[model samples]
Target: MTTEMSGADILIQALNDQGVEVVFGYPGGAVLPIYDALFNQQRIKHILVRQEGGAAHAAEGYARSTGKPGVVLVTSGPGATNAITGIADAMMDSIPMVVITGQVGTPLIGSDAFQECDTVGITRHVTKHNYLVKDPAKLGDIIHEAFHIATSGRPGPVVIDLPKDVQVATAPYRRTNTSALPHRGYKPAIKGDLTAIEQAIELLSKAERPMIYTGGGIINSGPAASMVLRELVKLTGAPVTSTLMGLGALPASSPQWLGMLGMHGTYEANMAMNQCDVMLCLGARFDDRVTGRLDAFSPHSKKIHVDIDRGSINKIVRVDVPIIGDVGRVLEDMVKLWKAREYQPRDLKPWWNTIKTWRDRNCLAYPASVESGEIVPQHAIRKLWEATHRQQPIITTEVGQHQMWAAQHFDFESPNKWLTSGGLGTMGYGLPAAIGAQLGNPKALVIDIAGEASIQMNIQEMGTATQYRLPVKVFILNNEYMGMVRQWQDLTYGGRYSSSYSDSLPDFVRLAEAYGWKGIRIERPDQLEQGIADMLAHDGPVMVDCMVAKMANCFPMIPSGASHTDMILDPAQVSGVMDDEAKALV
Candidate 1:
């Protein structure tokens, strides 16, 4: 049986068939028909964002937190363009998202039509795939293909540009159970290469000091591979470290876990990577943030790279054995091989002992100036982490020092747990994202670790959160400055703090109250735990103004234009001794 439906109805039906429960979007004239069709669809909850950018970011947050394909819809032209940044942000982070944009009628294609742009061409570079639906009959297939591309291997954003005429046109719609388009470029190796797995096993069986480096791909692939990788690390008795994107791939409290690695990585993790004999890189690209100076990174290690994308194999550092396959499948095969061969590295006691010594000596050192009457951002983050430890909570953050503090201090124990703008480093991402995340996981604890300046950028989202009664806790790091940039200026620009600080800042507590949400300010370290408890205990949305030190900088910083090797150990304690020690370790 076939049913006659408008293009918008077909699109919505297609999305519903694909299990899209929520969509973040802003309506316009071009998308009126689609919104009209959506009026009665109670199954799919539509979030009306204040801006198109917020819609995109909220979609991203939903995708990142729930490991589902985030859906965003916007009107044509400027509306579509506004979402470009957020789409690119998702692309860089490899988040699964489907962006739907309304277009001017197909007849008005290139006549400088009102609210029209070449959105398909504009978003080509940023999206994994895109479709300009000129024919209303093909709407369902296009949407199906869009979601398929978005959630497939190395997942990323996909755009479907719907012309106004197409949306209004009637078409015979069939909700097919399968996608119509074949993804030729996205060929993920589902089976493991037995030869490479054997080689990896042989290497691990003999290596004394070995380490496992992971990335976001592991999480994108789901928790099975991560579990296998963690088990492998435990069986081999090797230390494991993660990139910023890979933070939640392994339990942060695991004894084998060696904290995050890269520019701001702990000294122990960086030093261990440099000193290890065997490095097992699973689904992690050697990004500049992780590898600083390519020549200086893992100089003493024999690297083995396991990645689903063949392009990433030997893209940066040379690999001794390159296994191009799904990380989960590869690890399963390796585990079988290891069990069959009974492979175990011999006499690794001394190596592990040395690593433990290094881990103890060079633990992550943040400034603990509790009695100095200055609130430290790290302390606030730690308190938050303590309040929500391993509760399967969704933590989102904005850019700058607050982001770095969350990445450095928050103990993420599993994949699809921490959400942030990593590659794009986009500010004003937190509150909107947190709202989206709360919508995505209504029962889960969703918190936005936002900076005062960043939060104000999209502060209107507080109203949206309150309207939905989304219990999202927004912890505003109230430093009254752009903390990270200010730190750079203070260190390198001879303390020339320009536009970083402003005496005139909005009262966030009052702003929350104005938005019909509960708000509180925590000025002292002693009040942090109780404040967080009270905030968490609140039934609806709440905001905590965490007043932090203005000049506080993220530690283990790799100065801009400087190599990763040229990192500051302690921003406050820039003593020559720590600098010399850092240099010597490298």
Candidate 2:
């Protein structure tokens, strides 16, 4: 007794089977049938976003925070095109996401029908995988396949283009029960070779200056991976430094912890990477940002790269040991192997001495707020962490100076707490992402630490927060400039300023109020702590606009194309004409 159902019904049912609790999307002409089907569905909830781009980023936020594939539903043409940025961001950072777009009818696709574009063709490059559904009966299987491709292996966004006529047509819904579509071709390696594991351990056992470099792969592998990572770090007593995406994979309070290692990374971490005898790279690609000068990066180290993707190995920096498998599974095996031998902590006293010497520089230290009597952006971020009592809070940030400061100042002690646009560096990603995080964890204190200019990119999503009563806090470091752009001009372009100034900014307090939310403005250092606390304590959405120092720049920067050893440790001054306060606004 097979039941007949529309393509939309099968698609929605498949989503229910996959356990997608919520979807973020915008309604348009082609998607009307699916939206209609969605209205009566009790198993899934849909969040109607103001823009399609917000839908994609919100899904990213949901995926990162929940360890599940964030689902997106949008219409064809501009709606699908708007999601391109997030799709690319997820692909680069490896976040699991499924985007289903309603396309023009199959017959109308080539005819330039209303609200029609090549959704598959345009998104083909950005997505991990894409499908253009030609047959109505295949909708259910395609829906399930999208989830499968999005969440498996190195997770990323997958798109499905559903033609309007097919969505409205009848299907048997055969994919509803136990028989799932077999995907025999996409088996990712989950276990590494025993010999390789043994060899890796031998290197760990003998190395004096061993360091662990990790990235977003550990987080994408789930909390279990982080557990094994902590155990492995403990077993060897080696220094651990994470890339920007790997912040919460290791506890920030551990004695073995060096701060993040990269271009804007802590000096101690970068120096340790440059000098380590053996480097165990786990679940992290050697990104250009992390490797300042590829040839010079970790020149003294014999590197072991452990990643699930075999293609990622030796793609940038050649590795001495390449172990391809799921990071969690590999880490579990390593921990078990080490415990079987009853290994004691390695002798790291000398290594610790050198690290301590570098830490003595206090490279991460910004001017004291009380000393400067000014609200530096880093100081504000440090205060934000302090106000939260250094607890693991769900923190998201837009790209640029605020993102780096959030990464540097906030100490994340657990996985899945720090979310940001890591690889693509998308602006306007924070606020919507925070909304998704809040949606995932209703009771958690979710904050989007955004810069003033970047927040405007998807600022319209504030209404969504208010409508849902999500209790999201948008904490703006209102430096009145695009700080990173200004930093570059000061460093490379003779400080010309060149259209970086973000002038004619709106009154954020009024804007929040207009969106039916609470708003607070903090203009001085003394007002910050309480202001942030107030925003978090509010039962509903609140946006706090903190007036930050306009001229402040993020330091410990690896200048473009320079080695990690050659860092701009302090603010570079521009003499004569461009020295005025007006010249360097971002």
> By TM-score, who's the top model here?
2
lDDT of 2 by residue, 318-369 (tens): 9998999989999898889888977665688999999999999898888877
Off by over 4 Å in 2: 176-180, 370-372, 572-586
Model 1: lDDT equals: 0.84
lDDT of each: 0.84, 0.89
- Provide the lowest-lDDT 10-residue window in model 2: 573-582
Give the per-residue lDDT digits (tens) of candidate 1, residues 294-331. 76777788899988778788888999999988787888
Q: Which 10 successive residues of model 1 have the least lDDT summed?
A: 575-584
TM-scores for all candidates: the values are 0.94, 0.96
